[model samples]
Target: MVGEFCPRLVDYIVLVGSHSTNRTSSSIQTPVILNRFPPTDHEDFVLPPDVALFCQPEGCFNVVGSRPARANSDSSTPVRMPISFVFTLTDKESNKVRYGVCLNFLRPIPRRPEGRKHSTSSVPAVGEMPRRTSDVEFSQLPLPRNSDRRQEDTGLHEKKTQRARSSVRLRTHTLTSLCLITHHPFFTKFRALVEFLHTLIHKLHERSRSKRSDRETVWGVLAGGIPSTTSSLVTRSVQEIEIWMLRLLSAPAPVPGKTCIHLAVQPKALMKPLIFALPDKSRLPLVDFPLHLPIQLLGISRTLRILVCLLLEQK
Candidate 1:
């Protein structure tokens, strides 16, 4: 639904397939032995494989062969990041979460607007997660090799190799991000989001068009990130952004960015400012997204509350 992506985002590719799973499972299923990203097999796997540890099975995903992806990382020490196998983004410390990863894969249980349906699925009981899938995909990454093999292996190696190659259209709820950074705009049902992005792009272009301004100023902080009810630019922008975020957070899709790990999957009240919980379990509200890409990164609300208690939370 959107146009092309900047070439910089498309250099390396790793493919993941989302399969349908029953969300009513009792607990976290044990992850498969070999996860590709976070490079479980190759040497780069010291950091926590938070994404693969979260997936049910297919530690298998694709990094196209015959074309080993090279990373520009020169740092001797590896940086810890969530594993979505876009190698260029994954390898660097600076790849602060690019936008456009799908988190929700199941059809949302449509609620009756008028009828009182007891919301049993809102929060998981103690240890249980409402959905079986994690927001990020945990799969093995293809380490670039100097040469391609003319022959294949047998038995265990054969099985692992074959299994690793399969995945696509495995689930209806899953979104396919073609060529890596290009997500189908409808991936989130948030129509207002595209509108806001188009507006934002135009606004940014308009502002940056001035030769005096060197930095592209597409960012600002607000009343916490959720915005107050007073109708203004910040309010309108926050509302547009949150429409999809709440869905991503509300039990299922909590369609997430890497920061989503910090945010609770439990639904937040629309009547209040949108908040996220830290690894420490401390509460922090969202203030603003300083980047065009919101799929992978989000910051905790620390800036000035541009608007006051003026609470008119959008449902």
Candidate 2:
């Protein structure tokens, strides 16, 4: 059956219906590259050498990943994948800016379990200390039945109970259902990648949340401010990370003041920290993990919020 999982190599991903995230701008902003995927200016491992790594005003990059679906399913209520557009807030104005990647789930998303619509609780904030795995999980929930509600279960306390149950189910479903390659040697790269994501989130948040001037837009953030920019292998890691996702760094922009305004390839330089190369084929994982998997698994409603939570801690 074609329903079996296929992690074949995809040379490029076409980001469909990608639009600008600028909500307040009167003038329509154009994407840096229209319709063209990040090109392989040089040889590749996971992606081209010239991957779209950054999302800046002038040198913005684009990428997309689709939802996982069985190609040959014949059932009447077969699973359908929706492209839930995911974006991260760059500022109050650019709150809807695409996070620069459209990722995909590793497996087909399941139907929402049918039951009484209970109020769900707010997602827990990532705490200062490490998170402890909750004992309750989706695997532990008993199947709901027609007689699930009891005589006294309709009270306010029952609503609280139901909300707790719903929150547990939501988190558990995210943990179990979304499949991150369990044994992949990407663990080394995971931190680097997470740091990259962490920087993106923090930097964007800093720029957006802070009271900077509209005049400040001219002098954009520095590529050096982004993670892995200083390492000698950053150039190498960009190619390697592409094997896992769509792209990493945007093409090298000019370094006049070390910003994206001018266009210039960054000269290779070394730093104390290093971005290790991807493991050889003998040690690689499923070979690909979609960037938008969480959005498809859950939905657009909480996509960016959940991603922020996921990127909150490296553990």
What CA root-mean-square deviation does each model show from the true structure?
29.7, 23.3
298, model 2: CA deviation in Å?
9.2
On the 0 to 100 scale, the lDDT of residue 47 in model 1 is: 32
The residue-by-residue lDDT of candidate 2 on 186-234, one tens digit each, is 3333334434433343344345324533222111111111332333333
lDDT of each prediction vs. the true structure? 0.29, 0.31
CA displacement after TM-score superposition, residue 169 of candidate 1 (Å)? 24
TM-score of each: 0.18, 0.21
Which regions of candidate 1 fall more than 4 Å away from where they truly are? 1-25, 30-97, 107-315
lDDT of 2 at 109: 17
lDDT of 2: 0.31
Q: Give the lDDT of residue 148 in candidate 2.
A: 58
Instruction: Summarize candidate 1's per-residue lDDT along 1-315 as a digit string, tens digits.
Output: 212222221111122333323322223234332212112232322333343333324332222121212344322211121222221124255333333322211111111123444676667777886775543543454554544332333456876764444321121121111112222222222222323333443354334334322121222211111122333443454444444333432322223232322222223553222233212223442323324333334323422121222344422
What is the alpha-carbon lDDT for the whole of candidate 1?
0.29
